[model samples]
Target chain A: MLAIFKREMRAYFTSPVGYMFCAIFYAVSGFLFMLNTVQAGESANYASYFSILLFLFIVIIPLLTMKLVSEERKMKTDQLIMTAPVTLFDIVMGKYLAALTMFGSAFLSSSILYYIPLAIYGKPNAGLYIGCVIGVFLVGSAFISIGIFISSLTENQFISAFGTIGAIIFLLFVSALNSFINNEAIRNFLNGLSITTRYTYFSNGILRYDSLLYFISLSAVFLFFTVRVFERRRWSKS
Target chain B: MIKVEHLTKQYGDRYAVNDISFEVKKGEIVGFLGPNGAGKSTTMNILTGYLSSTSGKAMVDGLDILEHPLAVKKKVGFLPETPPLYLEMTVKEYLNFIYDLKKCTLNRKEHILEVCKVVKIEDTMNRMIKNLSKGYRQRVGIAGAIIGNPEVIIFDEPTNGLDPKQIIDIRNLIRELGKERTIILSTHILSEVKAVCDRILIINEGKIVADELTENIEGALRGNRRLAIRIEGPSSSVLSSIKKIAGVIYADISVEHEDGSATFIVESKNNVDLRKPIFYMLAKNSWPILSLEFTGANLEDIFISVVDEADAEATVGKK
Candidate 1:
């Protein structure tokens, strides 16, 4: 597992994809930060940053996760990883961790925007700031898992990226559809299923166990599915 | 040592490999000869635990591949047909990654150097794989496969893309590797099988058509009655005279030269050696014998005949 993780992480920096992902992420988030807070003359608050952060994730998550497993299959390097003295869990986890690490790098760099306001205005809500960071991390982790699972289904990077973006978009906007529903039970169930709703608790500095469990379990379930995809392929090829 | 029994792999309604069985004893270099899509790679993949057999078993060094994949994988080094490599990485980095993946306890730096030395890729160790030539990339792939000094090495088309010189170099390396490890090489190149393999297993359409020692495979194709004779005589007369012999099934002037001397390839009945009778006939006819040699069937002929017979049987079955 460690070996695969190390190789995958190195692969990111060696190719242009990793740098392109970070640059695009940083550029878009920086532009959003300047336009929303600086140019509009609004106070830099957790609420404003969280809103833009969610948008950032909707686009950036697919880029980070696009080539995770799909490129391995494309290059036929999956044969090496699959035939190694490692389990399918190890290969999936190693790739997931590598994608998460790349996302973390970009996520951490974007956090520099939080400090710009702290240096200028009165002290912002430290608790809210911390909450937003953790919230975005969890959201990104879950999105990365989804991307990994999608990537496992195909060898084309474009297809994997589009599939991930489509899925994330559906999950992100699922909360908005609740207004049209008259039945309270179905609305509540749909609201619970929404990623936006789950992230709302973290954005507001409320550490709800249900929300955390939801995100953690969401990531775990997708990762488990990814492993099963690989295992099933191994069995079918046999 | 590797033992496979009744191995079968089916895809949907089709059997990619159907009820095949073979064994490779320790220190044996076995050649798997088959045409494209003959299930050679599929069988090697199954034995290396890259794929699972639908039925039957593959045991490597006494461990069942399905039941204990890691244990079996640890003992086997596999170079798939495409030489699975991460092009973004340098040769050294790729090998080091493989060493770690194989969980080798040997001195990492020293072991890597030794492998590069063996595969003759030491000069390209620091170069990115994407920039290296196909032959060099293949060497790196082989290097990674052999990093842990696995007890068994399975190479699928190891010499597919190399030039003649590199092919010979790789063949020699495979022979050297066979001294300490059981090697199974799959290729359509019959000469390679004759050069490097101790035993040859000819597969046609997912079944083992012929399995025998390399020398015996050549001998089995000879069947004791085919001879190549060089004579200083008229082609028509010599052929006509040879065909009159009781044991001669047929005699044809295979090679005709501008000088009137010709070579005749003669086929005799089963269990008959026609050399003495041919010599006596030539002498009685006042013809001078330049040379007489037995030209037995090589691996190429045996492979073609075996595949042809299989195709004939399939045609008969379909009819």
Candidate 2:
């Protein structure tokens, strides 16, 4: 697993994919920071900025996870690793952790930009900052997991990326859809299923246990499915 | 070191491999000779545990491929039809990655250098696999297979797309590697097996039709079907009588004898051993035979005859 993780990390940096991912991450977040806080003299506490930037996770997360397994299949390199003395869990988790770490790099790079200002200005709300950071991280983890699971399903990188984008859009778009419901319980239930709505609790300085559980389990379910997809393929066909 | 028993792989309604079985003893080099889609790759995939058989089992070093895949994988190295190379990494990184991937316990730097030396890719260690030529990439692929010093090495057409020079180089490498470990390589080329393998297992339509030593295949083909018979009888009568025998496709007098005897060449249908039928037919007619011998053929003819015979039998079975 460590070997796969290290190799994945190298592939990202050596090719244009890793640099493109980080650059896009920084550029868009920088663009957001410029419009919302820098020109307005509001020292940005990036947690809230990140919560708003979370929608764009759909775009950048795929950049990191798109070729994670799909390219291996397309290039026929999967045969090497699959026939090696490693287990399927090692391959999946190693790649998943590498992608999650790429997301972490983007999060950290953006945080450094956002925190320098917060450190210079008046102190930001500690609870709100921590809560929203956790919220965005969980959301990013889930987005990456979804991206990777979709990647395991196809050999074409574009299909994997677009498929991930479509899946995430459905999950994030459900909250706005809840307002049309006449029944309050139905509205609340639909909101519970929506990923963006769960971020609201964390954005306002509250760490809801249910929302945390939701994202953690969501990521776990998809990661498990990714492993199953590979194992099932070995027994049968693609 | 390798044994496959009654292995059958079915996809939907077709059996990709049906009741296939073979074995390679320790320190022996075996070749699976077959045309395309004849299940050479499928059997290798099953032996490596990359694909599971629908039934039957494959064992390497006494460990079942299905039950103890990792253990079996550790003991076997496979080079698939296409070299599974990560083009992004330098050859050094790729070898190191394979080493780690296979969980090798050898000294990393020394082991890698030794493998590089063996495959003659030492100078290209710093180059990315994508930048290397096809031959260099193939060398790197072989380097990957022999890395970690596995007990068994399997290659699926290791020289499939190489030029003559590269093919000779790879053949020499496989021959060198065969001295220490058990090896199995599959190819459609007959001379390839004659050049490197100790035994040739000919597969046709997913079935083994012939298993002969490299030295014996030549002898086997000579004794196969074509016969040169010198008979003591009237020339026209001898030719007509030989033509009437079952399975004899062609017969003609080649040499006229002044003493009422002649040498005639006899050709038979695929897989038909006409020697016995001709012997009895001539004896029943009270014609003494002067001599009988097999007119030898090269390996190319032998391969075609085996596959053609297999096809003939399959169609006959369907009827």
Each model's total of backbone clashes: 1, 0
Error of 1 at B33 (Å): 0.9
Model 2 TM: 0.87
lDDT of 1 by residue, B1-319 (tens): 8999999988887788888999999999999999999989999989888888889999998899999999999999999999898888889999999999989999999999999999999998889999998989899989989999999999999999799999999999999999999999999999999999999998888889889999788766555467888899878988899999889887888888777789999988657879888899999998888888877566677789889998899899989
> lDDT tens string, model 1, A1-238?
8998898788778888788888888788777767766666645454676677787776788887888899988898888988889999999999899989888877876686556676676566778878878888999899999999999999999999999999999889988999898999999998988899889888898999988999999999999999999888878843
Taken over the whole model, the C-alpha lDDT of each candidate is 0.88, 0.89
Compute each candidate's TM-score over C-alphas. Answer: 0.93, 0.87
**Fnat score for model 1:** 0.78
Clashes of 1: 1
Pairs clashing in candidate 2? none
**Which lDDT value does model 2 have at B142?**
93
Q: Model 1: which residue pairs collide?
A: A238-B52
